[model samples]
Target: MEQRELGFTKIRLPVVGQGTWQMEEADEAACIDAIRRGIDAGMTHIDTAEMYGAGEVESLVGKAIEGRRDEVFLVSKVLPSNASYAGTLAACERSLERLRTDRLDLYLLHWPGSEPLEETLRAFKDLRAQGKIRHFGVSNFDQAELSRAIALAGPSEIACNQVFYHLLERAIEHRVLPLCERHGIAVVAYSPFGSGRFPAPDSMGGKVLASIAAAHGATPRQVALRFLLRRQPVFVIPKAARAAHALDNAAAGDLRLTSEDLARIDTAFPLGPDRGVLPTL
Candidate 1:
């Protein structure tokens, strides 16, 4: 599997990471089992959030990584409502407690909020200075908001900006990708399989994925995930609690899509199509 440096961070994140948002209320043993399988399958990054099930997700992830935290790039975020300076700081401390870690690999502001952007960025910078977090990032922030934060935050690195980027929802290509390209920021793609919508041919991912998956005897999920990995050095987080499902997503790293296949996918799901606007990336 190919790895990419998370912005300037020394950590080389894998192309596939495990997402913990939907695993909030999941059974403890089951969640641990899934995470264990994910890591064993060579997924080194994990994403979670404070707002998910009122911090239960982080707590479960913390428990899952009891002795293996050092091997994973653990990522957690504060919710959008906690965008104020003090609020964001307080939320980070809470996340640390719930995650049972003194420092985080990556900490993100969940979304663009009504509060001033500096207020949110200040909390991130101060946390980094205190060594509470190794990397800072944001989720669901549009391109303009990202630019404003970058300007206000001075020269500090913005490690990752996670958003929905799938065949059905490719709006970020116009708004987010160019800005990210300019600033050397890494894009983390969530819902790469289009959020459990029509799997392949019926969905915007199109028949190219199906044909490729058939050739390799893999599933549509792997094909879709690899598609995102092929575009712009992004890490894809597709949720799966079952071992078989996780393995399927992980297998995408093994197969490389051809140029013709990529072209077919792009044609089937154009980036800036007005008629088929994807939700957000």
Candidate 2:
């Protein structure tokens, strides 16, 4: 798979990653196999959070990467509720233990919360210094919040910003994305398939995607993922619990959409004025 730098960092990550959200212990075997399949297919960037399955997903991730840690770029997030300086310190330790790794390639603040951003950033700096985390970033932050975060930590301190971004949810395009581009913060787009809310294959939007997919001999999911991949510095982590689905998403990294195809997709799903409401999850 093609790789891109994470923000201004020297670390390069695959354009597509694997997301572990709502994965439970009940399906641990399947989830592990799917993750390994993604890795085998060159989707080496794996994202998870302590909030996912109450950390069970991290445990599963830990097991999956048991002896192949050197081959993956692991990322995890701290819950906003644990954004306190001391809480953040403790949270990192817990996450590191669950992930069975000494340091995270990238650590993120799950979202904005009641805690002061300064305190969280201070903890991030300390963790980096202590080698508990290599980089730090944020998730679900809009323009104003991201501006404040950058002001608090300086532009280069934040390595990325994970947000809800897709063809249908293009609110970030208006301001958030431009701001990140200015600061050189990589945009990690989660729920690229709308968390199962994507239009069916027979729907209007789906029909457009299908036509494009058919031309490329790809699935609608691959077409959607490739659309996101074409946006440089923007990485998409779509959840796939099945190995087949994981491989399907991985194949998107190789599917190149032509300029005319992009134009058609743009006409079908026009990017409009940013919605004032902040996107979540």
Candidate 3:
């Protein structure tokens, strides 16, 4: 699988990772198998959140990574409701317990909350100092909030900004992406499939994806994943609750769409109005 640097650090993450957003909705054993299959296929960056199933997903990830934990780059987020300085500390401990791990490769504030940003950042720093988490980032932050967080945490201290990004929603292209790129913060694209609202087969965008996929001997799903990887400092974590889907998504890492393919896709799925609101789950 292709790898990209995380922020300005030497750490490089797989361009394709497994997202455990709604894994709890699937069969438990199937979800575990899917995660393991994804790891074997080099989709080793697993992203989960405490908000997911109220922490049940983390426990499932813990089981999946069992003895092979060292092979994966683990990431988790703290819900905004639990992002206070002290709440952040407690939440990390709980996530660690649920994940059956001592430290997280990367930790993030799920989104801005009522707590002061500085307190949350302080907790992140303390966790880093205590070897509980290697790096910290934010999620679902808009331009103003992101800019403010960066100002408080300093550019280098913030590792990445995980946000919603897919073909139909390109609002971040207006401001967020440029800011992250300039500050050397990696951008993690969540819900890469747009919550399963794929274009109908008869739709123009659907036909375009099909044509491009046929050219590359790929599926429309793979084409969608590849389109998001066309630029640098951008990566995706699409949910894969079954082993077959996990392997299929992992294969997208090897796809190299041609310039013409990209141009055609851009036309088919043109960026809509920049509403200035970064989509969040």
Q: How far in Å is the alpha carbon of 130 misplaced in model 1?
A: 1.2
The candidate that wins on TM-score is 3
Tens-digit per-residue lDDT, 1-281, candidate 3:
99989878769888999899988899999999999999999999999989999999999999999999899999999998898999999999999999999999999999889999999999999999999999999999988999999899976998999999888887788899999889898999999988877877789999999989998899999999999888787999999989999999999999999999999999998887778788775
Q: Rank order by lDDT, top first?
A: 3, 2, 1
**How do the predictions measure up, each by TM-score?**
0.93, 0.97, 0.98
**Which of the two, 2 or 3, has more TM-score?**
3
Worst 10 residues of 3 by lDDT: 272-281
Question: Which residue runs does candidate 3 get wrong by more than 4 Å?
Answer: none
Scored against the true structure, residue 244 in model 2 reaches a CA lDDT of: 92
**Per-candidate local distance difference test:** 0.80, 0.90, 0.92
The true-versus-predicted C-alpha distance at residue 51 of model 1, in Å, is: 0.7
- Give the TM-score comparing model 1 with the true structure, all chains together: 0.93
> Clash pairs of candidate 2?
none
